[model samples]
Structures are given as C-alpha cells and as structure tokens.
Target: MNSIGLLIEFNDGRVKEANFGMATAARGENRNLVALVADGPAEDAQAVLEAYGVARIVNIRSGNRSWDPARQAAAVAAAMQKLEIDSLIGLTSPSGRELLPRIAARLGAPLIMDCIDIDLEAHRVRTSQYSGKTIATIALTGSHFIYGMRANVVPALKEPAEAEIIDFSFDGYQDTGYEVIETRTDGSGAHYLAEADIIISGGRGLKRAENFKLLFDCARHMNASVGASRVAVDNGWVPYAMQVGQTGVKVNPKVYMAVGISGSVQHFAGMKTARMIIAINTDENAAIMANCDYFAVGDLFEILPELEKALAAAKRSKEVA
Candidate 1:
C-alpha cells in the first residue's frame, strides 16, 4: 500500500487553512495519509489533521533552530524516505514553493507545482495553463511524486481518522548558514491576497490614497482581502505589495471584486482564474465589464460606503442572532 505525505504549513503557530485542502487531495482508497510539520510543533494540529483523513503526523526537528531552506528540505526528504511515503503533497505557498523543489531535487522525485487537482490512484494531476485559459492533465510515471497544490482550489472535506503523532529527528544537514535579518509584512490587516477566499481590489478610479480606506473598511466587514491595480500602486495610492497584476501578485480567490478598475490585460492576467469576478466601474465600456461575471456602472465612492455599512450590519445581526 502507498502512503501520501502532506507538507503542513503554519502561520502564527497554527495550521494554515490550505493544508486541509491538500489533505483532501491526498485522500484515496488503499492509501495511508500522513502529515508532516517541519517548522513548528505538531501536537496541537493532530486533531484537525485527523478530521482531514490524516492518520499519522510527523514532526520533523532538525535540532538547530534556524531558517534554512536547504536543511529543512533535506529533513523532509529524509522523513519521507523513513516512512516510505510514495507521494508528497503541499500548497503552492511561498515556503512550499521553495521547499518542495529542493526536496524533489534531493530525493530525485518527479515534481509538479500549482496543481489544481490530484488523482492519487491514477497518478495524474490537473493544472491551469496560459493564465487559466486552458486546463491540462499530466500523468506522472515515477514511483515517487512531489505535488504543490494551489491554495483553496480543492475544497476541504471532512474524513475522520484516528491520528497518531510521531517525533522525527533528522541530523542530515545542520548548517545554519542563513540568518534572518528582518521580516516585512504587507500590513493589510486581512488575509494574504493569494490565500484569501474573497478579494476586493481598487484601481486608478479610486482617485487618491486616502480613498483606499473605503476598500479596507469594506474588506474588514466581509472578512476578505484587499488588493490594488497597478495604476493604483503606481500612483502612490497603495503599496506595491497590494498590487494584483502580471508583474505583481497572482491570486486565485473564490470571488474577486474589482472596483473602479478598467481591467487591463496585465491586471486581468493575475486574477482571471478567480472563480467569480464582479466589477464596479463608471464606464459601461470598461474592459473589465466584458471579462467579469457581473458589473454595475456607478460611482464607487457612493457605492462603497453603503456596501460597507450593509455588510457591517449583516455581520452584527449574525453575531446577535
């Protein structure tokens, strides 16, 4: 029987929501499920991993507490080898993107990244190509495979399992060559744009920097992430980190709300894969109108405040109920 290993990621000492989706992709008949935690403790995550069909959790400790991608990848590869895991699955996150490839190179395994779906039984995976213009199914012929799943593409399904936690110490490579100088955050106060389920982005039509507060206020009430068009960033209305475009961050949110955006090709390339798109622009002939699922021609300044109030009221009502 083959075992599937899930590379669990953590943010602020808790499991990221996308790991559950990766666990869902790892599920199959006649296959054992294992979760691997490299950067943090695994005991607190055992219960949640169990709910996602993970029967065993491996906590990898390198003994040297340092941020070294090379060492961490070697440790993960070693753990997989010890457990005889035939497949390793992880999210296409910043850490996973850097870590998975190194592990693949170390283990000499066939690697696939940004996969939207995985068929464990058939050793096949589905990916979006040409900026989601087409879907491609690729077959893996190797006995061992490393796959990076796109965040939130696979909905997490609850499959209860009795899980056991194991501690694994790997002294394979212990060179703390890299030291962290500083960490920078986007400071959006919401979820990361790439990982958010819903996103609301502003563009040049927002006029000035202060107007971005409307976007932030509405985002807070919706529990969604905020993004900005390249024009908005270039005009100094928002930071470059908030930019969503071909040259900026690519997002795959469930719903992408474009406010006062003209939807240039570069901007569309980043968010075209969103499941649903809603556009609000003053021009009916705006390029975003044709590409979006829904659109409303209006002044965002007037519309946004009302939208924020309505969302806040609904949230308070839900909490009261």
Candidate 2:
C-alpha cells in the first residue's frame, strides 16, 4: 500500500469543497490517505476530511500566521518524510498552483500540475498540452511525486473513515526570508472561477465594461463566479484574472453559462469538463449553440434582465417556502 498524502486547503476556517474531490481521487481500498494542513484549523479540517476517506490529519503549526511559502514547503516536506508519504496530491487552484511546486522543489520530487487524471500505482498522469490541443500522458520517475488535480473533475465521493489530528512542526524548517505584508483582491473571496461550482462567462456580447453589472446582478442571485473570454479581456472589458480559455485558466465547474460567446476551441477546452453548459447567443449559427446542453437564441440585453428577475423571484419563493 502506498502512503498517500492530501494537502487540505481551507478558506475562512472552512474546508474548501474542492479538497473533497482531491481526497476522493487519492483514496482507494489499498491506499493509506492522510490530510496535511498547514497553519489552518486542524479540528475543522479533520471534521470534513474524515467524512471523505481520510485516515488522519496533520496540522503544521508554524506558530507564525504569515504566508511563508518556503516555511510551509519545509513543514509539508517534514511531514511527508516523517509519515513516509511517497505521493502528495492537491488541487490546481490558486494556492496549489503556488505551493505544490515549492514543496516539490524542496523535496526533490517530480511535480505535475493541472493534471486531468492520475494513476497512483503507475505514477502516470494525463494532462492537457499544446494549449489544450493534445492530452499528454506523463510517466514520472522520482523518489516522490506531487500532483495538482484540476477542481470538479474528480467526484467528491464519501467513504467514512477515522480522522485524528497530529500536531507537527518540522524538525528544521527555516523562513523563506519573505512575508506577505498585504494582499488585495477584486473583493471576491472563495468564489474563484476555477473553483466555483457555477460560472457565468461573458464575451464580446457584453458590449461595454459597465455591462458586466448585468452578469454580476445575475451572479448575485446564483452565487456564481464571473469569467471572460480572451476577446473580452483584450478589449479591457474584464481583467485577465477572469479569463477562461486554454491560454488562460482551465475550469471544471458543475454548470457553465456562456453569454455572447461563440465557443472558441480554446475556451471550450478550458471548460469542456463542465457537467452542464448553457449558452445564450443571438446568432443561430454560433458554435456555442451546437455544443451547449441548452441554447437560448435571443438578445442578451432583453433575456438577462428577465432571467435575473426570475431567478431573484425563485430564490425569494424558495426562502419563503
């Protein structure tokens, strides 16, 4: 049996739902699964990790509550060595994108990021390559391997298991000589596009930057993240961080809504894994119309307002009921 470790990501003291998917992918009948949390609430993490097949949770208490990449990497490496973990898996989300490589470098392990599929025994991975034009199968050969799986593709199936927290401070972990003084975002927290359950993306159809308010208004009712196509970002309609395509960020949300998008190959490659896709476009011949699960042909300006109001009414009615 392989000693497998899962990096637990938390937001606001709550376990991110995406971590469950990672756990599910790492667990099997012959695997030993453990959760490694760094500077987060171990008790809260254990509660969720335990429900999803984790055998134990290790809390890396660095005592300093600052964002230290090097120190965090050392702590995780220490745990990996002490626990005899041959492989570690995490999400391809923001933190995973940043932390996994650091840990891999520290541990001298081969790192694979944004992998679509994994086979632990063979140490093989299937990941997108050539800007989503090809799916490459990689065979890793090293003392250890770290994989970052894209969110949502792996189902978060629960198989109840025992969870116990172990407090671990690395034997010899030093600071990375840097600290985060301040962090600023676009005010959307825990609603990242790549990690969102539902994403509403706008394209050239938005017409103006201010028109995003319509999408935002709808998103407020649905609690969804906003995404944009390359054209929208090129036109300065939205920031690059919100771009969703092969050249941008890959997503695997449960439901993806494409508004005013023509469904370019790059854009489709990014969200093709989405379970459900809804498209709203005026052009009947738009590629999105054919590829989407549901298509609505109409003027977005007219359809969006009615959709938003109807959603609001539905939410209110549900709450009242």
Candidate 3:
C-alpha cells in the first residue's frame, strides 16, 4: 500500500480540528498514515490524530523564520521526500491556498484543490463544478499527488492507531522569494468562516446593517459562522470578509443556512460544496429556493426572530436536562 501524508495545521499551539477530516479522507486499510506538522507542538496532536488513524507524526523545524510561505512550502516538500510519501492531503485554508500549490509545483506532482472525495488506488478525485451544480471527476497520472479537501464534508470516523513523532530539520530549504511586510486585524473574530462546519448567511433581503443581528443572533446560538452575499456587502450591510460568492470566499461547510438571499449563481458558486443548504426567501420562485436542499417562503423578519427564540429555548432545555 502507498504511504499517505496529511499536512496538519495548528493554531496557537493547538491542533486544528479540521485536519481530522483530511486524515479520514486519506485513510485506507493497508495504507500508512503520516502527519506533517510545523510551528506547533506535534505531541499535543498525537492523541487526536491517532484517534482518526494517523500512524506517524513528522515534526519539521521552522528555523526561526517569521511568517514566510516560501520557507514553509520548502520544509513541507522536503518532509515529503524524506518520508517517501506517495500521496499528501490537506485542508483548504488561507495557508493551503499558498502552500499546497507550491509544494506540488516543486515536486512536479499532480495537484487537486477543494476536492470532496478521492480514490488513491484509482488516482482519481471528485470536486464540484459550475458553482456546485455538479461534480467533476478528474484523473491523474503521477508518482505523487497532493489533494486539498473542503472542511467538514468528510466524516472523521474514529479508528484508533498509535502515533510516533519523528523530529526532522529541513534547514537546507531556503525561501522561494515571496516576502511580506506586516499584517493587521480588525478583531472581527470571523476567521472561522473558511473552516466552519456550519454557516448562516444573509443578503440584501436582510434590509439593513443593524438587521444583521437577526442572523448573528441565530449563528451565536447555533455555534455557526455568519456570511453575507455580494449584494449585502455592496449595500454596506456587511463587510467583504463576510461575503459569499464568486468574488468572495469559497466555503464548503456542513450546513449552510441562507436567509434573505436571492440565490445568484455567483453567490452559490462560493458555497456549492456545502453538504446541506437551506434557504429562506419570500419568493417561491427565487433561485435560492431551487438550489437549496430545503427552503421556506416567508418574510425573513418574522422567521429569523422565531428561529432565534426557538434555538434559545432549545439550548435552555438542554442545559436544564
């Protein structure tokens, strides 16, 4: 069986739960599962990675570099060569957008991004196309291939295995020439959008910026992230970071709840990979209604508040129990 490598991501010294799904995707009966980790303590992730079938953890040294994608990619590629990894899988996030392609290009390997399914034995993978309207099956011929999967769509079922950590230093890897100045944040706490399992989005149907509270309130109660359509952002009802469309962030969450959104192809393009989509619109003939798994034709003002109240009541009941 071929060796499978999963690029594990960490946040502030902790493992990102999203990588478990990537592990699950790469798992096979006779395959060897290796985790490629950097920046964070790989030991901290041993238990969780083993729970999802990782067999080994390769901890790579960063060489005191400060936020360089080129350096990071070089280290990852070097690790792959050292481990003799035949295939690699990772989650599609901000870092992946830069790292995965570079690694693939450096290794001269075939690469697929935002994939929903992969069959390593067949050298084929499945991804969404035409704004999530259909699935495209792509075949590849290569000695090694890297796949970037959408978050939460693949179930990370537990199949335990013990993991051994291997310390590797890739100091020979130098930067490929991309440099950054500095980074800033507005503290919006919206970074989870790219990795969220559940998201609730609003559009022009929301009417006003203050009215976004309706969506935010529901999202908070449900532990779901909030998103906005291009229309909503253009109208100044929400920031561009919250926008979901062809021009906005592409998301593939488990459950996407679109409220007051008029289901345009551009917007659906961003969330077409969602496992389940529920739309709310006043028009029965709205484009969103046709594309959604389920929909309710009603005034969002009434439905949103009612949903929030019901969610709050449910949470209270669970707490009491």
Candidate 4:
C-alpha cells in the first residue's frame, strides 16, 4: 500500500506534524504516515494525532517569529522526502492553499485541491472535486500524488496507535522576502458551525438582531450552531460570520433548520448538502418549503419559542433519566 501523509493545523497557526490517522481509521488499514506539526509544541499536538491512528510523527520548527508559508512548505517538502511519502494530504485552509502548491512544485507531483472524497483502489487513487458538484476520478500517472482535503467533509476517526515523535530542523530556504507586521485573529466563534452536526439558520423574516436570540436559544437547546442568511447579514441583523450564502460560509451539517428564510439560490448554495432540511415560515408558498424535508406554515415568532421550550424540556427529561 502507498504511504499517506496528513498535514494538520495546530491551534497556533502552524501545521501539526503527524500521520493521517483518520484515513487509517476509515480504511481500517495502516500505512507509513507522517505528520508535520508547525509552529506549536509537538507533544500537545501529538495527543490529537495519536487518537487518529498515526503511526509516526515528525515535528518541524521553522524558528521564525511569524508563519511563513514558503518556509513551512520547504519544511514539509524536506519531511516528505525524508519519509519517502507516496502521497501527501493537507487541509484546504488558507495556509494549505499556499503550501500545497509549493510542496507539489518542489516535489514535481500532481496536486489536487478541495477534494471532498477519496478512494484507494488497487494501485490507484480517486477523488472528487468542485464542491462535489463534479467528480473527477484520477489515476496517478506518477509515483506520488498530493491531495488537499476539504475541511469538515471527511469524518475524523479515533483509534489507538503508538506514535513515535521525531524532531526536525530546517535551514537554507529562499526567503519569500515578505514580513507579517501585524496579525489579528477573528474572535468570532462561527468556525464551529462548519463542523457542526446540526445548524439552525434565520432569514429576513427574523425581523431584528434581538429576534436572532431565539435562533441562538433554540440552537443551544439542540446543541447546534446558529447561522443566518445573507439578507440578514446585509440588513445588519446578524454578523457576517453567521451568514450562510454564496458570499458567506458553506456548511454541510447532518440537519439544517431554516427559520423564516425565503430560500434564495445563493443561500441554498451554502447549505444544500445538509442531509435533512426543515423550514418554518408563515407563507405556505415560501420557496424554502419546496426544498425542505419538513415544513411548518406559521409565524416564526410564535413557533420558535414553543420549539425552544419543547427541546429544553426534552433535554431536562433525558438528564433526569
């Protein structure tokens, strides 16, 4: 079997150096895998990697004050060469966008980005593209192929595995000649929405920012995340982070609850992958009803609070059980 290396994202904005444990778990097989932990301490990151079934880990320290994509890429390429990796897998985050291309260029390998799924067959690998709207089954013409996995698409798995941590240091790389003078991280907690199992979203009929609290309360009761339509964001009723549309964040949760949303095409683009969609609106002819797995025709203000109370009572009953 070919070796697969997974590049992980550390909380410190560096790549976590470790093997692809989730892939191993999903496949029920083990391969030569190496993880690269960038920027953060390897020991802390190793715990998460170990849970995923990584066999070995390679920790790389760039010794730079800020995250330099080029430098990180150089480190990853060096590790890949040392490990003799047959394929490389990375998260399709902002850093991956910059690093994967550089690593592919340095290694002279085919790069596939934003892969939603992958299949390993006899002597070949396959993957999907274009937000899963299109499928491109690829046959690796070369010995090595690099893939960037879309975040939240692949289910992360945990399996106990012995992980050996190795430290590596790098030097003598071309400086991209760029400096990050100031860095400020967005404190919005909306990132959880991307990985959420369930999402509850609101639209223009939500009326005002204060009304959004109902959505949030319902979401909390269900242990779900809150989202909003682009119209709500544009109207200043919600933050841009909560917006779900073509211009906003894309989500593929197991269940989606859309409240008072008219279901514009742009809004549907962001959440159409939801396994089940439930829509609530006063107008029975609202566009959302047509696409919903379930629909309720009524005033949102009346329905939302009742739903919240019902869910809350259910939670309390479960706890008492």
Candidate 5:
C-alpha cells in the first residue's frame, strides 16, 4: 500500500476534528500519517488524527500565530523525504498553497492544488481541472504526487485507533525574513467563502450601497454569510471580503441565496458548487436563474422586505416554541 501524509493545522483546536474527514478519502490502499504543525490547538490535532486512524503523528512546535509558509514547506518536505511518503495531502488554505509548492519542488514531485476530486487507480492518481467547470483529468506519472485538498469536498471517515505521537524538530530552519506586521481576526467566527455552509449574495441589481442593508437583513434571517458579485464589490456596495466569483472567494455553501445577481460565468465559477441555490431577480432569463434550485421572478426592491418579514416571523415562532 502507498503511504499518504496529512499536514495538520490546529486553529483554536476546532479544526482538528476536520482532519478525519480529509484523511478518510486517502486511506484506502494507503497508510495514513498525520503531522501536526503546532501553532494553536495541539491537543485537538492529536485527537483528530487518532480518530482518522493515522498510523503516526509527528508534532512540531511553532510559537507564532502567523506561521511562515516557507518554514512549514521545508518541514513538510523534510518529513516526506525521511518517511518515503508516496503521496502528500495538504489543506487548500492560503498557507497550504504557499507551502505545498515549495515542498513539491523540494521532493521533485508533481503538485496539484485545489483538487475537488481524486481517483487513485493502481499507481496513477487522476484529478479534474479548472475548478470543475471544465474537465481535464490527468494521471500522475511521477513516483510521488503532492496535492492540496479543498475543505469539505472530501468525506471524513472515523476509525478507532490509538495515534502514536512523535516529536520532530527542524534545526537551522532559516526564517524566510517575512514577519507578520499586523494581524486582526475577523471575530465573526465564520469561515471564509470556501468553508461557509450558507451564502447570501448580492449583485448589480442591488442598485446602491445603502440598499445592501436589505441584503444583510435577509442573510441574518437565513443565518447565512453575505457574498457579492464582482460588479457589486467593484461598485463598493459591499466589502471585498464579501465578493464571490472568479476574482473573489470560492464558496460551496449548502444554501446560496443570490439577490439581484445576473450571474456572469466568472461569478458562477465561485458559487457553482452550492448545494441549493435560490435567485431573486426580475430577469427570468438571467444566468443565475438557470442554475438556481428556485427562482423568484420579481423586483428585489419589492421582494426583499417581505422575505425579511417572513423570516423574522419564523424566527420568532421558533423562539416561542
């Protein structure tokens, strides 16, 4: 069997539980190993890896909340070399993108990033490209395949096992001279677009920035995060953080409510993975309506308030119950 290694992150210890889901897909016909990169939440990392049936857990300590990607890359590359790993899987966060490439380069391996699906047949691993919009499956010809997995795309599995913890230290690991000058957490406790369960998006039809309060009201009622089309974000109706599309964040929310969006293909690139989509727009022929699970054909200016009232009433009744 091939051996696969997972580079783990412990953020507030909450994400340690997430590793089991990630490891499960790679474990069939593969020996699973997890390396816990200690920044925060180390204990959580140990628990998650053990639950995932990891054969070994390597722990490395770093004191900084903002970890250096290059250092992480070097550490992972060294571990891969030492263990003779056949395949390596990392999470597709900003840090993962930065680290995995360098690690792949060090190992002389082929690197695939943001892979939504993977097929391991014999010695070949096949992957789809262009974020699932356009399909091109390629098989790896190299001895080792390195990849970054999109969060929640793979089903996590749980197996009972005792995780063997091992400590590993990197000596003379030079800092890449990049220091985090400042840091501020979002405090919302919501994950980014790629990880959100529900997304409420606005678009060009919203007309003005001040009108976006209506969008926010609807999102609050639905208990969802806010997102925007590129046009809306460029128009300054919403913050750049809320933008969703090719130029913005990619989201796979369970329910995506798009208000006033015309849905350009670039915008669709970001949200096409949503489980259920609802569009509110006057244009029945809008591209968004075509892909939506349900569409309300009407002027959003007239429809938003009614929806907000109905959602509010439902919330009130639930609270009463």
Candidate 6:
C-alpha cells in the first residue's frame, strides 16, 4: 500500500474542519493514511484524525515561527521523504496555496491545485477549468504527487482507527530571506468566504452598497460570512475582496444563500460546490432560480428584515433553552 500524507491545518489550535475532508479524500483501497502537523500540537488532532482513519501522525518541529511558510515546507518535505510517502494532500486554502507549491518544488514533484476529485492509485485527478465551464482530468507523471483540494467540497466521513504518533524535527532548515514580521487582520471580524461554513452573498438587485447592511445583519445572527457578486463589486457596493465569482474568491460553504444574484455562470462557478444553495430574488425567472435547491420570489427589502428578525428570535430562543 502506498502511504498518502495529509497536511493538517489548524485554526486556534484545533484541526480545521476541512482537514477531515482532505483525510476522507486521501482514504482509498491501497492507501495508508498519514497526517502531518507542522508547528502545532499533533496530540490535539489525534482523536479527530483517528476518527477519520488516519493511522499515523507526524508532528514536525522546525521552530515556533508559524508564519514562516518556507520553513514549514521544508519540514513537511523532509517528513514525507523520511516516511516514504507517495503523495501529499492538503486544502487549497490561503496557507496551503502558499506552502504546497513550495514543497512540490523542493521535492521536484508534480502538483495540482483546487482539485475536486483524486484517484491516487490511477495517478489521475479532476479539476474545474475556465471558470467552472469544464472539468479537466489530469494524470501525474512523477514518483511523488501533491494535491491541493478545494475546501469543504469533499464530505468528511468517519472511519475509526488507532493512530500512532511520531515526532520529527528537521535540523537542516535554512532561512530564505523572506520574513513575516507582523500579521494583522482586515478588522472585518468575519470569516473569509473560503473558510466560512455559511455564506450569504449580495448582487445588483440590492440596488446600492448600503443595502448590504441587510445581508450583514442577517449574517451576524447566522454567524455567516458575507460575499458579493461581480456586479455588486463593480458598482462599488462592496470591495473586490468580498466578490465571489470566476474573477473573485471561490467558496465551498455548506449553505450558500445568494440574495439578489442573477446566477450568472461566473458567480455560479465560484459557489457551485456549496452543499446547499438558496436564492432570493424578485425575478422568478432569474438564472439562479433554476440552479438553486430552494428559491424565494419577493422583494429582498421586505424579506431581509423578516429573515433577520426570525434569525434573531431563533438565537434568543436557543440561548434561553
């Protein structure tokens, strides 16, 4: 059996939910699942990784500098080499996007990013191309492979196993001149769309930028991230960072609620992977209506207030309970 390495990502010291999805994707008939935790407490992730059938965990210690992507990549590459792992899998998150390519470069292996499906034994994978217009299947021609999966697309399933932990420290690491002196948040105090489990997006139908507050208010109660369509961003209703489309951020939330969006192909390409899609638009003939699992036809100006009130009431009820 070929050993498949899963690069684990942690948020606030807990295993990110998406790692389990990567773990699930790495499991196969002739694969031995291994988890790699760099600069984090591997023990903290053991129980969950075991639940996902990860039999081995490697805790790589290079230093306490979590922001050093080069150092982390070196450590991970060394561990994979020492373990003789055939393939390395990780989420196509911001950090993963930064680190995985470095590791692949160091190892001289082929790497594929934003992959939706992987067949390790066959050395083939599938990914979306041309803004979700086509699905492309690619075959790897290297001895080692690296895959960066889109977050939240693969479902995490339970497959219990007794895990064995190994601690690895790399002493041959050298600085690459790049230093992350300080990290700061954008101060929005909201999750990025890629990492958010629930996302509510606005579009041109909102009429103006201030109208987005309606989405923000509802999102606040639901603990969801807010996004915008290209039209909304182009109209200056929101910043480009909040845009979700082919030209913006891709999201794979559990629930994607599109408000006022016309369901253009570009916007759909970004969020089509969401497990559930709900659209609210005044036009019943909107393109989103046909693609969404559920849709409501009405004025969002009226619907948002009632929805916010309902969500707030539900929160109060749950708190009291």
Root-mean-square deviation per candidate: 1.9, 1.8, 1.8, 3.6, 2.9, 2.0
Model 4: per-residue lDDT, tens digit, 12-54?
Answer: 4433322232354234354655666655577776666776766
Across 1-321, the per-residue lDDT of candidate 6 in tens digits comes to 889999999887899988998988888887789999998889988998999999999989977455888888998999999999979999898889889999999999999999989988888999998888889999998878999998877888999999999999888888778787888988776576897899999999999989999999999999999999999999998999899999899998999999999999999989988889999999999999999999999999999999999999999999999
Error of 2 at 11 (Å): 1.0
Candidate 3 pairs with clashing backbones: none
Q: Estimate each model's TM-score.
A: 0.93, 0.94, 0.94, 0.82, 0.86, 0.92
- What does the lDDT come to for candidate 6? 0.91
Clashing residue pairs, backbone N/CA/C < 3 A, model 6:
none
Q: What is the lDDT, from 0 to 100, of the residue 296 in candidate 1?
A: 94
lDDT of each: 0.88, 0.88, 0.86, 0.74, 0.74, 0.91
Which digits, one per residue and each the tens of the lDDT, describe model 1 over residues 126-175?
98777556789999887689999889888889999989888999987756
lDDT of 3 by residue, 210-297 (tens): 9999998998888899999998999998888888878888887889999989888899889877889999999899898998899999
Ranking by lDDT: 6, 1, 2, 3, 5, 4
lDDT tens per residue, model 5, 12-122 = 556643455568777775465665454445455666567777777766544344666666677767766666776877777656768788888877888777666666544
Best by lDDT: 6
In model 2, the Cα lDDT at residue 212 comes to: 87
TM-score of 4: 0.82
